[model samples]
Target: MFDYYNLEPVLMWIHSTMCGLMPEWLAFTIEGIAVGIFIMVMYAVLAIILIYMERKVCAAFQCRIGPDRVGGRGGLLQVPADVIKILTKEIISLKNSDKFLYALAPFLVIMASILTFSCLPWNKGGEILHMNIGIFFVLAASSIGVLGILLAGWSSNSKYTLIGAVRSGAMIISYELSIGLSVLTMVILCGTMDIQEIVAYQENGWNIFKGHLPALMAFVIYLIAGNAEANRAPFDLAEAEQELTAGYHTEYSGMHFGFFYLAEYLNLFITAGIAVTLFLGGWMPLHIAGLEGFNTIMDYIPGVIWFVGKTFFVVFLLMWIRWTFPRLRIDQVLILEWKYLMPLSLLVLVIMTVMKVFGLVF
Candidate 1:
């Protein structure tokens, strides 16, 4: 079993060590501002890598070399170059746009994306906020991301912005039902909403495989709903560039537009992380029914490795879905959600609930 309250002792040890080595002011500063800055820096670095990788992966899928010129054969520095370009470019907010809300929306969205990480259990032993309701907290806080989108569109005072905002708002709202239902099914099977506890349930096998048919169905529904929730690919009706001419950020320029782009990718990462936590068994490794040696080797690998590897796989899958399919019309997107995903998720929830009640789960 995992220690639910282990971080307190670890923090005490760090506090004692810090007292022995440095002044109180220095310790406080390191723990307070420094830690927050470190997390944001890490977020920025990760975002940059994902941005470069997304472009390269998209190019490769379409039979082209992505960024050969930026930093050598792979164009690894393409993202940083893009960043410098944005920083040096003009800030062109529209005359009709609500300046305050237009400027504030991107940061709000990005902050919400960063905030979701607080409850993620990166390993068995550590999380910034290891709450019993970690899953609920993450899902609830992440929904706030849509608010920024709505603000950006409505505040921008453009028809394109309003349409994109409305589309995103509707899509997110519709898909969230399916996402929530899928998660409820998992919670039913695992019997806990604590992300660590859910991971512990998967010590034998991932929840996707544990509950068999019902879990499998939930997984499919989650993939569809999660993709829509993140506003990616076929469900990216919110900002269909060919149609909306840039969607909600149509009136945005320079760093403002950069913030929206950054938020989209960050939200993608967060969506993948949530999916890993729920069905793929965040940080928990695969375990066959009878292979103790294989299981032991899996256990030897650190939890963060398992968590991040599964997350990146999901992220790649999202990219693949985006590049391979044509965007759906907004009405068609909602219909898919209401007519297909939501029903399937509700049915799966019922099935899983029955399975759990009868003790038929793996």
Candidate 2:
């Protein structure tokens, strides 16, 4: 039986096997290539699956048939077809556009997501980058996405795109504080910037349960802010279709637009991934305090399964919010962050800090 508790041994064993087959440097090069391909394929598959899932989910929410056109059996192939369509779409040339910046925007967004995913602990031994400042790194990489949006808008030289990009900047700037403060609440409780350590610390109990109401509040705030960061509906003032045509990437077509599309879905995964890692215990299976027998059974399931399941659950929650809630006015969106969420997150952080100092945590 695989040692389900820790798969690092298995990974190391695989590495040793690969090393035995080739020179050390060659093996390392191969592994590096493999990791890059793994990340790319993982996100590509996830983005495609998420796109299909979103269509089906939103269809159900709106009493529509969804993507039932492609394969005649619930349109199972529709998402991929859409991918091909976008991938093949011609890149429209814009008059008087910034050649350098306009071409550079999508790559910025895509690269940010790629960098953020490197530190995300997908499974027991799946994190490619293990920095002590994992939390800070993730936040920093995420912040780069806003610059991409702003540039996309400005480079396009269109009033609509500029407005959309500026709106995105304002929204992200406002929400990032709440997002950071919410994560900080857990950092206080856990006392580590390492995301993997945070998950391991939750082996006994997830932070959402351990820190009492403060953790719960932080989770709520994080969900809202993260959703905003992904530029999803309700909080999707950045890409308000009704107002900005196609928003920041309006001038982009072909794969440039596809890159933005892919980044959006990948951002959703990162948001949900962070929530699962920090609040819901990442890949750790659920266990009651004394249910030794039950815990044993739960551990039999793979950590990757637990992590992906928990992540998609949160993603589902995000999609639910997007389809159900109406988009907020731009001012209302800012108010929700500055006046309400920001203050509330600060309070949550303070309460969590006191709980830790007093040792009153669960």
Superposing all C-alpha atoms, what RMSD in Å does each candidate have to the true structure? 2.6, 1.5
Model 1 segments beyond 4 Å from truth?
1-12, 19-29
Q: Cα lDDT of model 1 overall?
A: 0.84
Total clashes for model 2: 0
What Cα-based lDDT does every candidate model obtain?
Answer: 0.84, 0.90
Model 2: pairs clashing at backbone N, Cα or C within 3 Å = none
Q: After superposition on all CA atoms, how large is the RMSD of candidate 1?
A: 2.6
| Candidate with maximal lDDT | 2
Question: What TM-score goes with each of the models?
Answer: 0.93, 0.96
Q: Per-residue lDDT tens digits of candidate 2, residues 1-362?
A: 22555768877998999999999999899999998999899889999999999999999999997988797778999998888898888988788988889999999999999998788787776788888889889998999999999999999999889999999999999999999999999999999999888988898889899997999999999999999999988888778888999899888999999999999999999999999999999988888888889888888998889999999999999999999999998899999998999999999999998989999998
**How far in Å is the alpha carbon of 208 misplaced in model 1?**
1.3
